[model samples]
Target: MTTPRLEGRIAVITGGASGIGQAVAQRFAEEGADILLTDLAPCDATVALVQGLGRKAHQMRMDATSEADCDRMVEMAVQVFGRIDVAVFSAGVKTLPEAPRPGVDPAKATQLVHMSVENFRKVIDVNVTGVMLGSRAVARQMLAQGTGGAIVNIASTAGRIPLAGGGSYCVSKAGVIMLTKVMALELAQTGIRVNAVGPGYTSTPMWDAPEDSDAYRRAMSITPMQRNGTPREQADACLYLACDESSFMTGQTLHPAGGQFTG
Candidate 1:
């Protein structure tokens, strides 16, 4: 039998309820890692999927934005599986405030200037602040254990480019990119590696769009690959970062944008 890459490891995944998070959980479980799934939304589906893979799985409804919740989730992971070998911060808000409505022209839709502070702040709070809290909590546990760990933050290609109507999301992901670097540098001695994966135009429910829709066409125009990325592709990148395969790497971002943003 072929041994799994993550055999005997434990992972804590936030935003485990859906999309990229759900994909990662499934992949990690298949690789022989038990999962501790937490999210603001119900994660029964993901938990069941992971468990079906024959790996132990646990779930907790958590607000990633809450410092207390982040810490508690990490604690719960350790309690359930002894220790956390990897952490994937995939919990975040979509770049666009809302999906394109049918027959609505995105170009003529609400612009940034008309966007509300409430919406912008909410994105930052959940995306940037949540990353900070989760990374910190995971690092703390790793430090206590004295056995270094891995943290993979899910950034976006928009972080490396200027999105016309995605200023808030771009800014937040940019923050995540830099934060990953800073944490990586500070924790190098402790053996905790921090990195990010920047995905471009992934086909997720958050950005629901038909292939013939303008929304999909617009995304394809900017992407050099002329195609949308899949959640599994992003999950694979996270798997690389979370596993010992990238042990020598730290403070780096793996962009799986299909040539969208080379940087």
Candidate 2:
């Protein structure tokens, strides 16, 4: 029998309540890693899924934008599990709610020109700042433990390929990619690896358009695969980055983008 890739490892995953984050938690657990799942919402379902996989699981509600919350998540992971071998920063927002304003059409709010400053800032705060804070906290823990670990940031193809109206999301993901490179460079000698997974149009809550909707059709038309990627597919990319299989890799962004943007 093949041994589990993450046997006896401990992993911390943010945004684990649903979608890609939940899938990552499940995948890690199946590979024999104990998990601490943190998210803004409750993660009972995710914890249950991990437990069902016969791996230990814990859940904590976390606000990704708060520095204190980021530190608390790292601390909590250490408290629950002896040490963290992997940390996945997946907490992010595709967009933020906009306040009622004249001349602002809800449908076009995501456009760069129509996007409110507040909404853009919120997206940046949650997507870029949150990842930075989370990764920093986790890196500190790994340094203190004196055991090198892996950190995977969830990015998107939007970072590399601009979307018509996804200005905030694209910019934020681009920031994440650059941050991953910087982190990897700084932590290279420390035995810690920092990488990113830029998934294509995956089937997640963030892309919950009706199958027959024009939005869905347009998205699929651009994907060479002509189908949306599953959360598990994205999780697999993350798994490779987090495991020994990718020991030689750092400061890289894997794109499972269905040929959307070949890098």
Residue 108 of model 1 has an lDDT of 37
Tens digit of lDDT per residue, candidate 1, span 21-70?
A: 99999999999999999999999999999999999999999999999999
Query: Candidate 1 has which clashing residue pairs, if any?
Result: none
TM-score of each: 0.93, 0.96
lDDT (Cα, tens digit) per residue for candidate 2, span 70-122:
99998898888878999999998996656666888877767888878888999
- lDDT (Cα atoms) of all candidates against the true structure: 0.90, 0.93
Top-TM-score structure, candidate number: 2
- Compared with the true structure, the alpha-carbon lDDT of candidate 1 equals 0.90
**Deviation from native of the Cα of residue 157 in model 2, angstroms:** 0.3
**Model 1, position 120: C-alpha lDDT score:** 80
lDDT, candidate 1, residue 28? 97
